[model samples]
Target: MAEHTAARPRGRPPRADREQVVHTALRLLGEVGLDALTMRRLADALGVQAGTLYGYFPTKRALLTAMAEAMMSGCQDAGENAATPREQVLALARGLRTALLAHRDGARVYAGTHAVGPNTLGFSDTLIGALRQAGVDAAAAVQTALLIVHFTTGHVLEEQAATGADPELLTEIDDLHQAIAQGEYPQLAETHKELTGTDFTQLYERGLQLLTSDVP
Candidate 1:
């Protein structure tokens, strides 16, 4: 409502239409993986021409940037009242995992796409501010925060590609095991249980612990 104050303009659609297109794009990206989410498909999903979609996003890069911004919005929704810099950073990491987990190839969609958006910038400010308050130098604070963020995102992306949302990977691992001969791949054969049994929740918590602990 606030975005549509419309001081002047009768021929134009409301700003909400742009947001709707962006949201449609986000959903399409979720349903179909990023590789398949073309502008034409997004327009088809939204029942608009591909040219209309370009009014909101002139190029594939712009569409992707919007989706990345949506991911940041998701982070803001999760980052409410995060008290400390570490907590805020951790909140962002958790938020990303949550968003990517919801989509078919979510982590892949988010990977290498960290353009500054409202949510990310705010949370970043929160984390970096906390670090500065704790007497950390600016360079160290930024480097530490980015390191943790990248590690969290990279780990989740690998997990998503491996497991999907349904834990279908367990079934797939059964097939991979057949290729590992005891005599030739003893290390892998022996560690198969450990590798398969472990889940991302444990991995995330442990890595979070290590990253935070290493920060000081």
Candidate 2:
């Protein structure tokens, strides 16, 4: 005389998973930015009820973390097969920037979240392993990994902010450039063209060199 409970049905599944939620959230982030990124909004975009998202993320912070992790996932390829620690780190840095620049307010979204997920942690491990292989101490390797991330994220944030500036701000910048061109500022005027130009790649490479110069 025992009561039997039926097993949970494993049908075709709910047609939603953490990956789909992250994808939809990323699309929404690119469309509406981080300020307007909400579970409700994401669910609406995915054509699912808001509560269903909670089943995957449990909280808004969780979703943001997942998004950041997903963003970093593509960067793993940068360091996967690099021949040297410096190259690995450089590739990782460039890859991170590329990924961040791919979405609207991407750097802001990534910089604002702490993603300790598999993909994020994997990238960290790759960097740390490379540094360790290059003879850096364990603690310093970890710190260097963090430094690379912070530097790349900060640089991308600034780059995106500048590139996305409003016309009014841009006009102000142009006016300032003209004023500087009039030789009101000697140093800035001397390098006006270079200053006004976009050479983030060189700047980024220079920074990476500074970071990795001492490594062997």
Which parts of model 1 have CA positions greater than 4 angstroms off? 1-16, 74-85, 165-172, 184-186
Per-residue lDDT of candidate 2, residues 66-173 (tens digit): 888888876778877787777887788788889999988888888868788878887778878888888889988888888888888898888887787457768877
The count of backbone overlaps in candidate 2 is: 0
**lDDT by residue (tens digit), candidate 1, 1-216:** 557665665554323377898787777776777788888887777776777877877888877776766766645556557776567666766776786677666666667776677866876676666566556789988987787668877887888777655576767787777777535888888887766664778878888888777444
lDDT of 1 at 162: 74
TM-score winner among the candidates?
Answer: 2
Q: What is the TM-score of each predicted model, taking all chains together? A: 0.77, 0.82
Write out the backbone clash pairs for model 2.
none
Best by lDDT: 2
